[model samples]
Target chain A: MQVFKVYQQETLKYFHSIAILLFVTVGVSAQTKTDTTETKKKPTSFVPTGVRVGTDLIAIGMTRYVDSYKGWEVNADVDFSRYYLAVDVGSWSRDYDNGAEIYSNNGNYFRIGGDVNFLLKDPDRNMFFLGLRYGRSKFSESLQVNKIDSMWNNNPVNERYSNSNSNGSWFELTTGIRVKIWKVIWMGYTARLKFGLTTNEDGNLIPHDIPGYGRTDKNVAWGFNYQIFVRIPVRRQQ
Target chain B: MEFGLKAVNLSLQPRVSTMKKATWFIFLLIIIASCLNDPDCFRINSNVIGISFRVMGTGKSDTLRMYGVTTQNTDSTFYRNTAATGIGIPLDFTTTESEYLFQTTRGDYSIALKYDVNVQFVSEDCGSKYVLENLETTGHTFDSIRLVSRTPGTTAGGNIEIFRCPRTDTMAVAFRQLTLSGTTKSSQALVVETNGITPDFTGETLYGGEKVSIVYLPVNLDVDKHAMVIDFDQVEGGLRKLDLNYTLTETQRYRPCGVQIFASEMIINAVESQYAFDSVGFVLNETNSSIRSVLDPFDPMINIYRCPDLDIAGIYFRNRQDRADSTVSLKSVTVNFQTTNYAPTEPTTFIRVPLNKSATNTTVTIEYQTGKIETLVLSYTATPITRFRVACSDQNTLFTNLAVVAQGTTLVGSQVPNASLQSIPTRNIEIFP
Candidate 1:
């Protein structure tokens, strides 16, 4: 009973994540499998035609130039008619010192959802689409605070606090475009409005930032990613 | 060849146009992203809760004098020896529960509160802030407390109002004298000196060795009559008993105040004393149920009056060698050109003579039984004291520092003892002749 009570919150979080994934998969697959009896009369174009694999260039550039930031993200999508299934995986680590305190955090995150291409009939298969994603992160953070209390005889306070094995989740409404420059090489941007953020109660040490969701203080945060991709054809276009 | 080249250019035209548009979009996105900065530190946050006091029956604001209010974990005090109707206190931000100990004049009480703390690290420039919510009173030791607001603010009204019942058993009696102002009559407060006062119901002596014009006497809740004995000074039979009668009505006026006992229809039922009083009347007929001011609780329900005090000093002739009373014969005695019938037909050691209330000195002409007359001068300081208001100003004078400035021939010496003269007569000087 004691062990179950201790892990109850973690178990509930995992259950929610699994429920969202199942809902997305079942909903999309059910939509695609509709009217199969009329497939002989009208050919269905539901089969995946190509896959795009990409890496965020901005994250790489910040990792190289910004002293306090080190992070990278990879994105991939498989096309099914005018709709596509998208997935993202990323890792972030930050170390900051601002005279009064030292804070550091590191985490890994993943996002899975679907996107609908609005520019469906473009000859080059260039895309402008709006999508939704369910993102979850698992991370740990530590902070060391230093202060001098002038009221209490100038007493010096040096206290260290840390939160280990914390989990956070959020949802993102994404809008961007994917443009094809050449036969296989492609470039695009994804602008994300992230909201509905929640996290595990970690006693005292509140997290300054979530790995995939940016700052944890705000209710809604904005993100932009400039990505480069290579398109590999999985089947011949009908 | 010309046809092939033109077709290739046509195919590349849309591709080139799409690339240019994408470049512009990316450039605009980068510019907007670079402008996203952290928020400024401007908001003010506090973790304070307010508490106020009220009287149960009237729901009036009540003042409370607190010795101090402290928490278990900290040495700091919230309000130390501070008197206020409402006060603001801080809740512990580091924990979910807090308990405060209140030390007051009446007794010590405690209140425990439970809440949730939501801390947010806003930005690097703003640092962090905490908001306390779901404030609840888990336990308390006061007579009654009502939670007015769960989400407390920094206002002075406070979130909790503490209630206590008003005092209903005690009543005040004032001493006053009536004087004629031309054709009109007015009463002024008269200070009486007493050894002690004994209430018949409790049989306890109160306010011993003190001078008080107004006195608070308790009403016997079991009966309608309350009597007390006042011990006056320098009287043959010093005890004066006064019996008071009243009617008590028991009714629940307000549910929160509970059943209140009110006394009214007051009557000065009886007076048993050897000495006579000028008048005794009911000034305020009802026992006060509400306190108008915390500082002034005396509302005098009864007014007992005596004739105003006389400006006089008592002197006893004592032999300097033995410190014993000495007798001397006198034909006539005059004080400040006014003759007083104070000297007895026979020789006496003690005499009471009136003083000059407006003068610093008095001339006494003593014609000894030897038929030789001698003029003696007595010097003293008089301080004008007012008891009630400006209308009664200078109605009484306090004489002090009495001395014999001149003793006519045939007197050896004289000494001033107990220089201050009080309403009660005590020996003020001694003479060696």
Candidate 2:
């Protein structure tokens, strides 16, 4: 009976794994069907092999506070359609220190990357795109003290402090899916697991996320990204 | 039949959906475009317009006549012309009573007189009455007359007449002298009637001890003239009463009677010098001198001067030409020096002097150190009359002309060889050394 029970448990485990896989597959299939129906109504245009322009929002998560940054991004793939050269410009303001103090940062980001997409199913809609993004993320910080300094000294003083900038190379592998909503509108979600390849104070490869680094954590860190965009197609002369 | 029905249903459903999507997209585009094209705008405020008026006349006590209107519009383009009726007045004069009355009427106006003097009197016909007492006099001797009303009620509609007599015969003689002694010194006591004419009381005073005489003077109702005379012998130590009375007589028409003499005397001597520098490098030693009785001291002026081959510069003494209350006596003389050189030029400089005050009798020396000798000519010019006035009273008509008399000029120094000298006759020339 003990052996029978062990066999039955193993079977149950297998069924459970299969059910999870089926759930993910079916959910994706339903989404794909909707996208296909919408796309079929409009004329298809050639996707440019050399240029890709996109936008993104970065949620800065820290021990004390969290902030968001949103802006546009444009990229040119030079070598084969898989190699990407990108530029991202964005600005963000945050109240991290406390409600009494605030911080803001803004700059441009540039990257040279490569990506590969693998089709999981017969339909091109069920695919996972894996890309390595290598870019220089520059950041600046400006701090403003909204309240008087509360220290041993009775004197009340307000202060404004700022930092010029700091930039470093970053690399990340992002895997996501692209789903078409309308003929021109696209909806996508991605997961990026990144490593800084550069050193932190501990002399080890820094995690992707740090106070000064562009990401929230270092080594083996994962981030979920989402985006909605419209594709403006340029017509070719007959 | 089944196959046909299925085909029709499929085609109709897709067509309707496509049409709906296209229509929605077009509507969104139109709304967004409209919002982007519209914007807010602004405009500037308009400007306000204003008007003003001015009246000109002679003597300190002379009546100033002015008239104007306001159309209640702030437009600068609108204007009113009163040249034909002598009533063109700016809109700003609506505040003054005299200006208001003049603007409403297009006829001549004169200073109404009560006795021999001009006084303000109330009439029953007029809605309100205003009287300005102790009317100041212009420094020069002049006659002043104003409109007077004599009806008992507020509506005095009939013609009002005025008369004049010497102040010595009035009951308020002390008041006429501006002195309040034991008498009440009321101006009302001087009102009297004579020769079927009633005149109001007016004050008159002669400046110098000259004789006062009266002749029929042509009266210009539009421009009334007043003459005041004080006789030194008639008063105690030349302090005589200036009291005079006026009575109003109701007549069919307003007519001023014969001229009545109050007091006659010579005017106080107030002379002014208008000097000009000559081109021959000389200054005006003296200019024209105006003569009158010696009541006030004379004050001289350096009118104008010109450097040799240069410009002429000087200022006319306004005190001497116009009458002022403050005493202006000659204190000292100053000459501004300048020099200029022009080759091959014979410059003849002219200077005018008040009669007998020029440098003709005085020594005039001209010394040349560098330039060649040239002819030097000193010429004299009589002062021309600056202004002419006609004075008219009920019984006296007189014409007064003011002028600057020039004496002569004397030339000094040796003349250059072959240099001709000529003396020219002209008016209003100045040569000062």
Local error of candidate 1 at residue B354 (angstroms): 55
> Per-residue lDDT of B58-151 in model 2, one digit per residue for the tens?
1111122334333322122222333221122222111111211223233332321121111111111211111122222122111222323231
lDDT against the true structure, per candidate, is 0.70, 0.29
Q: Candidate 1's residue-wise lDDT over B1-433, tens digit each?
A: 3554222222334434544554465456445443443454553234678898877756778788999999864668879999988889877665678899999987998999988765545555655555676789999888789888776442333678887766677777787765432223466787767777777677777777777898887666666433434433413236666665667777785565678776666555545435334456666324744322111133676677754343666767777689789898978777865756566689988677778987899877767688977666789888765542333344456677788899877555777777776545567767665
**Which of the CAPRI classes, incorrect, acceptable, medium or high, describes model 2?**
incorrect
DockQ of 1: 0.07
**DockQ scores of the candidates:** 0.07, 0.01
Task: Indicate the residue-level lDDT of B186 in model 2.
Answer: 15
